[model samples]
Target chain A: MKIYEFAQAPNCRRVRMFLAEKGIKMEYVHVDIGKGENLAEDYRRRDPNAKVPVLELDDGSHIAESVAIQRYFEEMHPEPPLFGRDAKEKALVEMWTRRGDFNMMFNVGMCFQHTTGFFSDRMRVFPEFGEESGKKAVQFFSVLDQHLEENRYLVGDYFSVADIGMLCSLDFGKAVKLRPDPAQYPNLVRWREELNARPSASA
Target chain B: MKIYEFAQAPNCRRVRMFLAEKGIKMEYVHVDIGKGENLAEDYRRRDPNAKVPVLELDDGSHIAESVAIQRYFEEMHPEPPLFGRDAKEKALVEMWTRRGDFNMMFNVGMCFQHTTGFFSDRMRVFPEFGEESGKKAVQFFSVLDQHLEENRYLVGDYFSVADIGMLCSLDFGKAVKLRPDPAQYPNLVRWREELNARPSASA
Candidate 1:
């Protein structure tokens, strides 16, 4: 099995962090998304969506999307249980995972793509919407801050894929000039500090 | 268990359809989103995100987000599995699920929210982005149409939540004057017709 990924991409980092957490090692194939290599016909055949961090199984079947790739491994390695141990915990983890993807990652990505026109060669850029999305991302930090005030992690007390999702997204927020203001979101900043200290964060 | 939702919301409908498919009946508690009832403190306490289709378990804990709620039951039921029966199929299903979400549902939703200013009371709306998102939605239909020409379902011959997510989003596309043009996307239209024939579609 191999992972086709651009290491700098936030979604790629998410998959890497997940694998690191599970202590699962695999072959890595670099897809240089920055150079528009992902748009090439060969890469598109690997993943029609042309996204990085696609997991190619031994049978040559490919799985795209960060959560899906992570879940594939989670199912294979059910040791540390990053997804969750039971139904309720799994539901909560999934909820937070989706929340982080939609509220944090999407906004940060939009802010980067639209504001910087990073993908202008492929897609249209809308700076106005990008500006609004950046603000929306900051608003989510307030919500995260309040939630983190009572809990050490996004769901319950243990580290999970939900935290990993938020960690990568928030870290990637730097490209868009987005960061939780320590004064305004002290709890969120505290949570970030804790997650960043983890070994998997470097993945 | 009970569900707190606005009947007409696409996400609420998605959950209702999933339950109907699973043959699970639960009490429905309406939260009138059209009148901003979801923004009320009580509803916010029920779900800090203030979105619909929240499942309230017998123990009084809440599960927000359609996928998470559906997954909670999926674990409990595990019949004719909508998520997938194995690791590989599960990964593919999840990949398609996230694809339908990011490519179709999100674009349709952005078109509705930004173009119509339906949620102007709650958030900023950018019509330019909405227009572009509508075009992106059509582009995704082209991709779906081509895929459907080869397979009956998004992942395989069997129906899964990926199709459900697309079905609800495409149906909701009508609100934003978006639909797969039968002449242009014949395969997609055919696939839609098949899913629409399902009894659970009306849910």
Candidate 2:
């Protein structure tokens, strides 16, 4: 399998962490988002959307979307399961994972797209919207902090994919100045440190 | 089962369609997103994140997120399957479904949240970035138009969850002046009609 990636991208980081957790050593093809390498013809064929972290399997099948890639990994390697074993556990993991994604990951994405204008040439042409996107992203962090106060992980006791996905966005959030306060989000700070201590989290 | 929902929300519409397709009669509890009902104590208990389309199962397991709810329904019902059967087929379904989601559905979400500010009181605040979010949505539609031109459905050959997800966004897209142009997307128009004509299209 091959993974089209970038080190700094949270979405790409999610895939890296998942691979590291499962100890899966697949080929990695770096897509330089900063240099617009992903915008070139060759990269476009693998992913029309032109995002990082496209996992291309040996059979020539490509799986884009960080969540979908995470799900694929979950199925292919069920031990130390990221999605959990039973239907209820799986649903809970899926539910919280989506919550983390839509709320935090998207907030982080908007902060970057609308504010940073990194993909202004290809994705968003407007720069006026970045400030407000950055604001909403801060609000989203509060919600996560509250959740982390109760659960060891984002969803439950186990460190599921949801935890992996959110940690990337939250840490990235700091780079764009959307960091959660230690006073307010102590639980999240604890959990974040826990994941950070892990070797996969470093990935 | 009980579904907390609002009709116009594509997220809620996703669950409605899934339930309708599975032929499950779920009791409905309207959560007026516009009126800030979702943020109230009662609804937040169902989902601490305070979002719509929370599925409270008979066994008391709560499933949030439209895609997660759809997964639960498919897992329990498993007939007239929405997600494909085999590993390859399942990957295909997930691939397109997620593409449609990020490229279209999530963009539509950006369009709505950033442009309209409908949910402003309950943290829908900020118009500056939201407008940019909406335009980003329009950009995504162009990607969809290109894909729809070649494939019969978002994935291929079947009206799986991806089609349902796209239809919800495309139909919802019109509310924000983001409809696809027949001149630009002839094949998308063809697929749209076929999807609209399906027995479960509206479901």
Candidate 3:
């Protein structure tokens, strides 16, 4: 099995970090997003969305999207149970994971794309929208900080995929010059520090 | 055993439809989003994100996010298997569900929020950003049209929650005056009609 991805992308990093956390290793095939290789016909056929981090199964079938790929691996290697352990915990993990992905990670990505013009050649870029997206990402930081004030992780205690999603997005937020302020979000800062200390964080 | 939601909201509708598909019934507590009831301190305490469709479990704990709520039910009622039947199908369903939620539904919702200023009292509104989001939604409609040309549902034959999300969002697109045109996206229109015909579509 191989994964087609651009290693630099946060979405790809999410899957990599997930694999590292699960102590699983797989072949990686680079599709250079910087060179617009992902937008090519071949890659687009592989994933109609043409997004990075498409996992190729042993049957030659492809699964696109980072969360979907992570789900596949989590099902295969249920030992660590990154998704969750039970029904209620699983729902909470899914909730926080989507929140991190949609609000935090997605806003950071929008800010990067619109403000940096990195993919301006491929899609329309609105700097104003990017600025607003930056603010949105920061707003979620406050919410996350408030939540983390009492909880060890997003879903409480368990270091699930929710933490992985937030960690990668928060790390990628550097590109957009958006980070949770130390004073404004101390809990978030503490959580980030703890997650960064993990070896898989660099994956 | 209770769901806090506004019936008209697309996200809330997604959950309601999912429960209907599962043949499960629960008491509904209405939250008037039009009156900003969702932003009230009590509601915010129930869901820090201040979003509707929070499922209050028998234990009195709450689960926010439409997909997460549906997941809790899917776990309880595994017979219908709205998520998927196996690892591969589950991944595919997850991929499509997220694509619909993040790409199609999110863009449409953004267009409505930014253009209509529906939440202007609480959030910033950028009409230009909304216009771009409308275009993005339309782009996904085209992609969906092409995919639906062959597949009966988002993840092939089974009518999973992925289709539920897309159906709800597409219906909500009416608020932003965005719909898949039959002339341009015949396949999407066809698929939409079929799903719309389902009794659960109105739930």
What is model 3's native contact fraction? 0.67
Residues A107-156, candidate 1: write the lDDT tens digits: 99889999998899888898988998998899899889999999999996
TM-score of each: 0.98, 0.91, 0.97
Model 2 preserves the real interface contacts to a fraction of 0.43
Question: Pairs clashing in candidate 2?
Answer: A114-A130, A129-B129, B17-B203, B111-B134, B114-B130
Per-model C-alpha lDDT, please? Answer: 0.90, 0.78, 0.90
- Deviating ranges (above 4 Å) for candidate 1: none
Error of 2 at A125 (Å): 6.3
TM-score of structure candidate 1: 0.98
Residue A58 C-alpha lDDT in model 2: 88
The ten-residue window of minimal lDDT in model 3 chain B covers B71-80
**Per-residue error at A104 for model 2, in Å?**
1.0
User: Chain A of model 2, TM-score against the native?
Assistant: 0.92
